[model samples]
Target: MERILPSGFRFTPSPAQLIGHYLARKLCDLPIASNTINDADVYACVPAELDSRFPSLDRFQDCRYFFTWRMPLAATGARVSRKVGSGGVYKGTQSAKDVVDANGRTIGYRQSFAYFDKSGKKTEWLMEEYGIRRQVVDGTKDLVICKIYLTPTARRACDRR
Candidate 1:
């Protein structure tokens, strides 16, 4: 809610930066370069509710990022739950796809989802979920980075191929 940067500033970190740097530091409880990305119960709220959580920080109107905890769903083991909020569910368009660094080293995993309303109607909202590799941290990871945005027109172009 506080303005830490100049007006009209934009913070669009790449997938590498999201997982390799910020998220990696997050797993270790380290500080990041900016407070633009916030902590939230991502799965507990519909994508539309995000605006209220961070407000319309002018420049961040189109994209919002959050650090959320992944709850273990299995009865006896580790299985990150995907149960979304009552308003809707995030239907996975792609599962844990490998995200590699520029040098071709696997840094983390990325999952893509399209938001569907309670009635099962797809919405324009989309999300990219990122989780870290053990190489970045030494233990079982529970926290994740969630980036939510409207579906880009470029996505339709990609699908054309």
Candidate 2:
């Protein structure tokens, strides 16, 4: 039973809150503080359709977050095809960076991705994928929390240094 909230409601958790609280509880099979996060295969949908596909309490109604499995395409867990959801691929724009906790310990990883059109043209859509190194109860890779949104500015403006 999913509880739906108002559209204007905001769920702006910090990186630590997202990983330490929501994600950790989810993997441990514990109850979340709130039913604000949705478990979905984010790669299966396009960035533009996320809001309607997996709606949550978005801040300013401009962004969306999803909890998805970090399942790789091959058994080796090295190869993956991100090209799903309407014939486009969400290519990684940068390397995976560490998301540290208050004590400066790396608790999870974050990676940025930019969507490219079917013709290989870069779109204004952007995504930040966060994942941990721990495996789930089923012995799969860690679950991921993806923050997807359309860039408020030009694509390069959102490029992290």
RMSD of each: 5.5, 5.1
Q: List the residue pairs that clash in candidate 1.
A: none
lDDT of 2 at 111: 87
- Per residue, candidate 2 scores C-alpha lDDT tens digits across 1-161 of 35676655678888877888888888799998667777777778777677567554543445777898666666556544577667889899898888889999999988899999778889888988877765344334557888888787753363543
Error of 1 at 88 (Å): 1.9
The total number of steric clashes, by the backbone 3 Å criterion, in model 1 comes to 0
By lDDT, the best candidate is: 1
Model 1 score (lDDT): 0.77
* Runs off by more than 4 Å, candidate 2: 1-9, 56-61, 135-142, 154-161
What C-alpha lDDT values do all the predictions have?
0.77, 0.75
